[model samples]
Target: MDRTPSFLQQHKQTFQRVGAVLLAILVWQVLAMAVGHQLLVPSPLSVLERLAGIWLEAGFWSTVWFTFRKIVAGFLLGLALGLGLGSLAGRFPLFEILFRPWAVMVKSVPVASFIVICLIWMSSARLSIFISFLMVLPIVYTNVLQSIRSVDRQMLEAVQIFRLPWAKRVLYLWLPQMKPYLISACSVGLGISWKAGIAAEIIGIPSGSIGQMFYDAKVYFNTTDLFTWTIIVVVVSVLFEKGFLALLKWLYGRLEKL
Candidate 1:
């Protein structure tokens, strides 16, 4: 086997990605200078400086913590419901028929409309959690149900013929098959959850939340602050996705090994 350096082999793409980000930032900085109005477009350096300041503020961490908890709770709730409902629907035609309409309605209805209506029943503080849950549920349900349905009939038949134990079927068949669909659902779901959650907060303007700060930034035309907060959201969303996917991939590897 060739003994190449791990960082060189594994992180060449990482270096390329970092270069791309730097290029984008350079372009943004140039555009900001061309605009010549700080309110309209703050330079990249100004935004970075603002972000650094926010990182040091005690209130920033509190806001982040609150938002993180709400969004993550919503995501977990949606995932659980999706798994439970998807399994039922996949196993039984009746369940599929019963659940598909609701899922379709959730998918078809505009998220804004849901936010408006939900606000009436729930406090603004809880808006993000509910909206996140609603947005993520359909995607998860569809992916999982499809994964269940897409199991190769021939392989299933072979397993049945072989009279394999349920544990073996799960280990060799179901786990392998569900891995991709689960990862895909989660990857998509988590991103959307953060987006929807933040949007909900922005609309609701819950006090002391990042959304409130974002709204303040917009209201006051604080372009640098807006850019800084936007960067924070993007960073948090990306980190959450990467961390969650890493956990999912690790679990998958462990399951496969078993």
Candidate 2:
């Protein structure tokens, strides 16, 4: 009964992305050939070869797990605190005023400065957690506060008039308004968390971390390893972002149905 396009025809965006990636790889191959130096610019194939075997190497998964847990812990802490503080700020103008200066300071201060300062307070092994939390906190806080402040007064009045239960009020009223802002915050915050966390690890050089591998690669001038690790970071970050967003959207969808 349907007269729709073919499956491939429906996936135009996917095909375009594949084509773009292939073109980029081709360009990289050409540039590597022109350079004629593996140390300076390894070909895509070389990086791929390294990527294929990097997982088999000792401590690879443990290193990845170490960084992953730290980054995720930081992100979750930021999200929880941001939402809680943002809710308080949205409800009370005085609280917002008191917190404004601190938020501004955190937002304006450089990440390197924060990392160096934090190192004095904590060990290198735990540096990524604080760095990622600091990086993500302001973003989530700002987005959440804005979203809450922008809620329609008329909708709030209606909920009160109906005398809805607190759970229903949140699921039916607040969640819808907050969904977009929260998703946006999470998307941006997740990427920043990874980048900042990795940077901290690199600077702190915690043993058996992906960032430590990056530092080692730089110290040894292993361009192929550097590129391979870069690819791994990108792929992992993208995958996590996609999966988290999908789950968030799904949760919102299920909540809305209730």
Residue-by-residue lDDT tens digits, candidate 1, 1-258: 978888877899999999999999999989999998899999998887887788898788999988989999999999999988887898898999999789999999988899889989999999999999999899889998999899999999999999999889878988788889999999999999999999999998888888998899999999899888888989998999999999999998898676
How much is the lDDT of residue 181 in candidate 2? 95
lDDT scores for all predictions? 0.91, 0.93
Error of 1 at 210 (Å): 1.2
Candidate 2 lDDT over 1-258, as tens digits, reads 888999999999999999999999999999999999999999999999999999999899999999999999999999999988888898798989999998999999999999999999999999999999999998998998999899999998999999999988878877798899999999999999999999999999999898999999999999999999999888888899899999999999898777
Quality of model 1 by C-alpha lDDT: 0.91
Clashing pairs in 1: none
- In terms of lDDT, the best-performing candidate is 2
Candidate 1 deviant stretches above 4 angstroms: 1-12, 162-168
